[model samples]
Target: AEIGKGFLLPSASISSKTKEQMPAIPKEIERAEEEGVKILYLTLPTEITGKNGRVNGLKCVPLVLDEIDAEGRRKPLPISASEFLLK
Candidate 1:
């Protein structure tokens, strides 16, 4: 399984640059869906110093080079996000 981090932020309290750095959750979900993945797990850090308990940063998604896609593009399988958060 792959592992990574994700950040969360309040609606109007985070910087634009920080927001830009965050990964697109919808895209991740989409990619997983395309693969026929049965489960999607996410880890949300409980304690954060900025923006009143909201997250503002995320680690890069851990991907495994499993195979090539229909377009001759290498596809990666991501680790479960739940494992990290529950810990």
Candidate 2:
């Protein structure tokens, strides 16, 4: 992905004991601050949508990387825009 033209690669870390991958939300926040990103668009699962209409935390969902479409490309994950804040 380009610096500001394309999407940033998903930032995550893998657990040593359980071998489970975890999203590095703090790291992503740091990166956004460093890059001077005013608004970061995130697509977290609906399960994480918190109380008071806020989304909190991250949960890793297993994906079959080998699965592809007729174009041999991975399918895009579904996303629903819950709320939008504008200044």
Candidate 3:
């Protein structure tokens, strides 16, 4: 489980992704203070890449929901988008 989330563990990390990669991210870092998130590192998901360098999506669910052994991480219900990083 520790290895699975290794990429996000660093304090100051740099990731390279365009809007095409993950539509969730902002396109430009115009003002560092303007955006709420202070990015530390970049993480590359295990997915196929197209010629355009865009992610083709994951083949599997990554980990089976039933296989999750961490009790704290095992959410009884789906999490809201706002509190996603907290848990």
Candidate 4:
């Protein structure tokens, strides 16, 4: 009960997760930028989103797509389940 409550609070749940990413995340983002991999969306279609817009359920891999440009520059694109899975 309390565990689920935390998700609805004043964004505390996200703060801790963000803190854990730390300085490493900035560098990782930079590297990803070079690799043409950009993070477009924050959630996946596989997860169920509640009325409050919070994703509820277990998640395995992140559903990001690698739609790089002809020059190989990664363009951050939105994703769908069937579209991604089929590819």
lDDT of each: 0.38, 0.40, 0.31, 0.37
lDDT of 3: 0.31
- Residue 65, candidate 2: how far off, in angstroms? 2.1
Q: Return the TM-score for each candidate structure.
A: 0.26, 0.23, 0.17, 0.25
lDDT of 1 at 38: 29
Best by TM-score: 1
Which lDDT tens digits does candidate 4 get at residues 1-87?
A: 223334543211111112233345677655654544433233343433344765444332233435667997553343444332201
- Residues 1-87 of candidate 2 have per-residue lDDT tens digits of 126546553433323211123245667655754665543333232334455876555443322333478997654343333433221
lDDT of 3 by residue, 1-87 (tens): 223345653222223333233334344442332433444222322334354776433221112122335564322232123221211
What's the residue-level lDDT of 23 in candidate 1? 57
| Pairwise lDDT winner, candidates 2 and 4 | 2
Q: Which stretches of candidate 3 lie over 4 Å from their true place?
A: 1-14, 17-27, 46-86
RMSD to the native, candidate 4? 11.4
Off by over 4 Å in 1: 1-60, 81-87
Worst 10 residues of 1 by lDDT: 9-18
Give the clashing pairs for model 1: 2-79, 8-55
| Per-residue lDDT of 75 in model 1 | 43
Q: Write the per-residue lDDT of candidate 1 for residues 1-87, one digit (tens) a residue.
A: 022213232222121222223355767645654544423232223333335676544433334444667888554455456322211
Best by lDDT: 2
TM-score of 2: 0.23
